[model samples]
Target chain A: MAHIHLGEGSFPLWALVLWTLLGVGLISAVVYRVRKGGIKTHQIALAGIAAAASFAIFQLNIPVWGGIHMNLTGLVGILAGPLLGALIALVVNIFSAALGHGAVGLLGANTLVNASEAIVAYYAFKTLIGMDWDVFPASASAATLGLSAGAFLMGAIIVVSGVNGSALPRGDLTIAVAGLVGLNLFAAFLAAGYWGFTVTGGAMPWAKRSAKALQRGVQEGGGALVELGRGIVVAGPIRKGGLMVEFGALVLVLGVLGIGLYVYVDRYGGFEDGERPAR
Target chain B: MTVTTLSNHVPDPRLVTAFAEQRDGPLHRVNPWTKIGIVGALVLAVTVFDRLALLAGLYGAVLVVYGLAGLPYRRLAGWYTLPLLFIVSVAGPLTFLEPGTPIGGTLPTPLGELSVTWAGIVLFAELSCRSLTVVTFALTASMTTKYTDVAYMLGRLLPRPIDQIALLTYRFTFVMLETLEDLVKAALSRGANFSEFWSNKRLYARILGMTMLSAIEQSERLVKSMEARGYNGDITLYGDVSRPPIHELFVVIGSYVAVVGYAAVAVYGVRQ
Candidate 1:
C-alpha cells in the first residue's frame, strides 16, 4: 500500500527500467519458490485472500488519529509471509494505477516499495517476538521500518526524477519532496510506536513471553546494547543505493532540522484524498 | 470481462471500466497495441526533450486528438485535475524557490540573495507540461481501449504464472471492494463508526481483520465453484473477438515519425 505521488515521465527511463527490472526479478524469485509446490490450489486461494484483504483495507483510508488514516500494511505481513505479502502489494499497486491513484509507469517501483515494507515487517516481527520483546513494540517497529525504507526509496526517486525532464535541475522541488518524505518517515515511526503499545499494551492471550533466563539477562545489564545490535541488523538493505541515495537521506534529515518545525508537507503529500470520503 | 476500478462512490460497473464499450471512431478504431506504442514513444520523447515549447506542443496535439475522438472536456478535467495539481506540488515552488545566477531581479532572503534562475523558470514549465502530457496520454489510452484486451496482449508477452496472477488479482479486487463497502456500512450501522483516527484505531483494525477473514472464506467458495465448472486453472479472463482488419503499418510508421522526429528536434536543436 505504498502510494507515491509520482507521475509518468517523473523518472528517467534508465532508472525506471532498472528499478522495474529489479522488482520483476524479486517477484519472479518469489513466484518460482512458491511454484516448487506446484500451483497448489490452496496456496493460490490463500494468496487471493491476502491480496483481497490488503486491497480492501488500502482503499478505505480509515480515519485513525489526528484526522490521519491508515491501511494495515503491517498486519498484512504478520498474517501472510513474505511471498504473499509482496504479491498483495503488487495487486494493490495495479488497482491503484487503474484508478488514477498513481502512475502506471511507476508500477514496478511501487510494487518493490510495498514488498519491501511487507518483507521488513514480517521478518522484524518474527525476530522481535523471538527476542521476547512486547508484541506491540515489535510489530509496530517492524511496520515502521518497512514504511521508512519505502519513504527513503520514494524520496530518492523523486530527487533523481528531475534529471529526466526538468530543464535547470529543480533542486528546490527536490528538497521539498525529500523533506516531505522525511516527515512521512517520522510519522511512520511515531505511528508504529503508538500503535504497538496500544495493540499489545496490557497483555493478549496470544502474546508470548521470553524465556526466564533471557528475561533475567535483560534485567541485569548491557541488555540495551544487545537490542540495539539487533535493530541495526533488522534494518537491512534492499540493494546498494550508492552515493545519490545517501544524498536523499541527507536531504530528508537536514531539511527537517533546518525547518525547525513540524514539516508542513503532511498537508499536501500522498494521495490527496486517499481515505474514502464518507459516502 | 468485469474489471475493478477505484473511486469513492459507486457508479455503473461497466462505466468504471476505463473504455467505452459502444463508441466507435478513430481513437477506438485504433488498435490497443498501437496506443501503447504511441504512449511509450510520446512519454520517452517528452522525457528526453527537456523543452517547454515541445512539451506544450505535444500536449496540445494529444488534446486535439481526444477532441477529435469527441471525448468530453469535462471528463478530461475530472480525471486529470488532481494529478495536474500533484505535478504542481512538485514543480510549482520552483517558480520562486530556486537559487542560481540572476536572470533579472534578485531578492535578499535570510540565507542570501534569492534570484529566479532562467533555468528554474524553464524547468518548471517543462516539468509541468511533461507531467500533464504523460498523464493525459495515459487517461486517453485507457478511455479509448478495453483494458482486458490489453491484458490479453500482455498475457502473451509475459510468462505463464505471472499472467495468471495478474488476471486473478484484477478479477478479485472488485470482489474485495464490494465486501469492503458492505463491511464499512455494517460497521457504521452498528455504531462502530470511525471518528478520530487514534481512538478508533482498534475498530479500524477489527474491520481490516474481518475483511481478510471474509475474503478467505469467499476465496474457498469461489474455488469450489470454479472447480465445479471444470476450470483448469488457466489465465482465461478474456473472451474471443475478431482482431480488427485494419493494416497497422501506417500507424507504426506515423507514430515512429512523430515520436522520433520530436525527439530528434530536442537532440539536434534544443538548447536547454
Candidate 2:
C-alpha cells in the first residue's frame, strides 16, 4: 500500500547509494540471523507460500479509493515470522521490479519500506495479542499501525532522498510528502475503522440512530456540529461505537490535515509563477 | 474491477516466463550475467546523466536493443502504463511548481497562479526517459533470461534460507495466483459483487482471509511432502547460468567505464 512508485533516477546518486546500502545492510542482518538460528523447514515452507501470496495479492486491485491494492505485508508478518517476513518483502520487491512494476534502482528503498511494514506488524500483533486483545481487533489495529508506519517511512525516504529535477525546496518537499503520507494514513484508518465497525456489528445500529438524532437536531434548528459533538460525547448503548467514534474523529482530522498541507504547499510552497528558487 | 479483469492489466509472470523460455533470439543466447551487468550499467548511466538529449538517446538505444532482442514492442508499450503513471504523478506537480519562462500564460487556480514552464516540461521529459529506460531494459532482461537461470542466479546470489525461500516462492506464485483466481471466480459466481469497496469491505476482507488460510494449509501439506522426500531445509536448483564470455565481459566493463567517465565529465566537469 505504501510502495514507492517512482521510476529510476527519481532519486539522486548519493541518496540511491545510501538507500541501497541500508537495504543491503538490513538483508545481510536478516540472512545472518537466519543462518545462526537455523530456520525450521515448516517455517521455510510458510515463508515461501507467504511470499507467493503477498506477491500475488500485491497486484490484486480491490475496488477501493478508485482501485488500490493491499500490501498484506502485515498479514505476511503475522503468518511468517519477521525474519522470513522481511525476506519475503525482498523477494516480492525483486519480482515486482523484475516485472517492471517498480524501479530496479529503488529496490533498496522499496524493500526498506515494505520490510518495515512486515516487521512492525509482526511485533505489533504480538504485543497486542500479549495484551489480551481479541484477534480481530489486535490484527486489524496492528496492520493499520504497521501500514501507517510504512507510509511515514516512505514519506521520510522521499523527503530525504529528494526527487531529482524537482524545483521544490527541501521544506516544501517535506510538506508535500507530509500531506501525501497523511492521506495514506487516512485511507488506512478509514478502511480499518470500517472493517472493525462491520465485524463488531456495532456501527450500523449506532450510525442509524445517530443519523436520526442528527436529522432531528437539524430540523429543530440545532446545528449539525452540535449534534455531532453530542453524538461523540453521548456514548450510546454500543460500546464499540466509541472505537468507531475515535476512528471517525481521527479520520476526519487526518483528512483535514492532509488536505490542508496540500493546500499549503499549493499556495505557499514557493511555486509562484516566474519565480525560481535561487539555486 | 473484478479480479479476472484486473489480472489482465498486471504483468503476468506466466507471460514473462513464456517469453524467456520460448524466444530464441540473440539476447536469449546471451549469458544471464552479461545481461544483468548491462542492466547495472544502464542504471548507473541513467542515474548520472541529467541532460534531456542524453537521456532520450539512451532511451532510444535501449528501445532499439529491445527490438533487436525480438521482444514484442506492443507489449513493451503496454507495460509502460505503470511507469508512465508513476512519472506523471511524481513529476506532474513539478511541471507547475518549477519556475521558468512559462510556456502558456499563468492561469488563476484556487491555490495560486499555475503555469507550465519550458524548464518544467524539459524536466518531465528527462524524468520520463530515465524511468522508461530502466523499466524497458529490466523487462528486456527478464524476458530474455529463463526462469530457471533466474532461480539459479538467486540461489548463487542470496544466502541459504533466503535463496531457498525465493526459489520456492517463484514457483509457487503461479499456484497461489491460480488459487486466487479460482477464489475470485467462485465469489463472483456466488453473486458476490466487488464493484464498491466501502459496501463490500467485508467481502474483500473475507476473500483475502480465505486466501491466507488456504496458503497456510497449502504450506503445511508442502512441508509434509518435502519432508517425506528427505528435504531438510536446503532447496537446490539444478539449473546454472554460464559465466559471461570474454567479449561480453569487455562490453560490460566498457559500459561501466563509459558511465564513470560520463559522470566525471557531466557532474564534476572533469576534462577528458
Candidate 3:
C-alpha cells in the first residue's frame, strides 16, 4: 500500500523529468558497478534472487489499522547487495504499479525511493555486519534506518513534486503535504516493526514464543481481529478481480522463489551459499 | 500424505498470468514501449491537471481509451476503486484538517477546533482527481501491454547489466512465485489453516519465519537443479518482441500529440 498517492499534475514537467533522469542515472551506476566487478557465473543468479525477493517482500501486508505493507528493501539489500537491489527496486516498482499494488504515476518517484532504500540499507547492514554485530540487530537497525529514509523520501516527493494550487490554496496544500509526511513516518514505523519481528522473532524459540503471542492476539481481539475484519470486508471484492490479494500473495511467493532460484542458479554454477561472495 | 490434498487448495495464479499476457484490444496491439511513451508523455503532462475541467477531461479520455482497448469495465473496476479510496483517505481528511473556507460551521473537540472547509474539500477533489488521472493512464498501459514486452523494452532501453537484470527478474519472478506456492501448500499441510493464518498475525509470522528459513535452504537446493540444467549468467526470451503495427503506432502517436496539444494550451494559453 502506498502511503502517499500523489495524483497527476502534482509535479511539473521538468520535475518529473528530473526525477526520471535521477532514477535512470542511479540505476545505470548500479548496473555499471555490477558488471565491473567481473561477476560472470553465480553472481547473476544472486542478483535474480535479490530482485525476486525484493519484489516479493514488498508485497506483504501487515493488515494493521487501515492496513500497512512492508517493502523489505533493507532485508533484500542485505541479501542481494546494492547493485542487484537497485535494479530489483526499479523492476518491482514497475510490476507493483502495473499490477495495481501502488500508484502508477508515482512509479518514478517510488523507484527513486526504493533505490535509495536499497543503497542506504545495503551499506548500513554491511557496515554493521562488518563490525561483527549479530544478524538480528544488524537487520533491525538497517530496516528501521532504510524504511525511515524511505518514508522521508516519499515525503520529499509529495512535497516538492506536484501542483497544489489547483487543489486548495498554497497554504492548505503545504499542511496537507505535511500531514502526508507524518502519515508516511507512522506507516513506515509499523512496517519496520513487522519486518524486525519477522526475521528476529521468527527463529525457533522465538517463533514458538511469537506463535503463542499470536494465538493470544487472535483470541484477545488484537491485530488478528483487524485482519479478519479486513478480510471479511475486502475478501469478496478481492476474489472478484481485486489484484491486492493476488499482488501480496504472489510477491511473497515470488520472494521465496527468488531465493530458491538464487540457490539453484548459484549451485548450478558450482557455488555454495556460504561461499557466495565477499559482498 | 496431506501434501497432495493441500496442493489442491492453492489458489490459481491468475494475476501473474493476467499480467504476463497481452489482450487483443486496439491498445494492446501497440508495442508496449510506444504505449509506455504515450503514458509517460501524458504523465509528464499531468501539470495541466490544475484545472477541474482539464482533469475531468483527462479522466474521460482514460475511459474512452479503455473503451477503445475493448477492455471490460468490471475487469478494471478494482483498479478504479483504490484511487477513489486513496482520495478519501488523503483528500477527505484535508477538509477537516486544513483551515480554509469552512463548509458549514466549526466544531469543538478535545483535540482542538475542527472545521470542514469548502476550499479543502475542493482541494481534496482536485488532488484525488489528479491522482486518478495519472493512475488511470499508467494502468491502461500496464493492463493492455504484456509484461514480457515491457521488460524487453526496458532491456533495450537501458544499458547492458541493467537489461540483463530486467530479463532475469522477469524469468526468475515466476519461478519464485511457483516456489512460494509450494511452500504455502506445505505449510497448509502441516496443520496451518488458511483462515487461521489470516486471522492471526503472529502465527502468520511464525509460518513466514519457517518459509524464510526454507527460502535460505531452497536457494541451495535450486542451485543444484540449475547447475544440472547447465546454468549460465544470461537470460533468453523465447521469442522476438514485436513492434506495434503501423496503424496502432499512428493511433498511439496521434493520441500523444492531442494530449500534448491540450496540455500546451492549458499550461500556456489558457492558464496564462
Candidate by candidate, in order, the iRMS in Å equals 8.2, 6.7, 10.8
Question: How much DockQ does model 2 earn?
Answer: 0.37
Query: lDDT tens string, model 2, B20-77?
Result: 8888989999999998899899888888786889999999999999999999888777
Highest TM-score, which number?
A: 2
Winner on DockQ (2 vs 3): 2
Candidates in order have lDDT scores of 0.59, 0.74, 0.56
Q: Total clashing residue pairs per candidate?
A: 5, 0, 15
**2 or 3: which has the higher lDDT?**
2
TM-score result, candidate 1:
0.72
Mark the 10 consecutive residues where model 3 chain B has the least summed lDDT.
Answer: B1-10
TM-score of 3: 0.72
Model 2: per-residue Cα lDDT over A7-113, one tens digit each: 89888776777678678766765665465445667778878887888877766777664566665787676666566767888989888888888888899899989
- Number of the top-ranking candidate, with DockQ as the measure: 2
Interface RMSD of 3: 10.8
- What would the TM-scores of all predictions be? 0.72, 0.82, 0.72
Cα error of candidate 3 at position A63, Å: 2.5
Q: When superposed on Cα atoms, how far off is each prediction in RMSD?
A: 11.2, 12.6, 16.3
Docking class of 1: incorrect
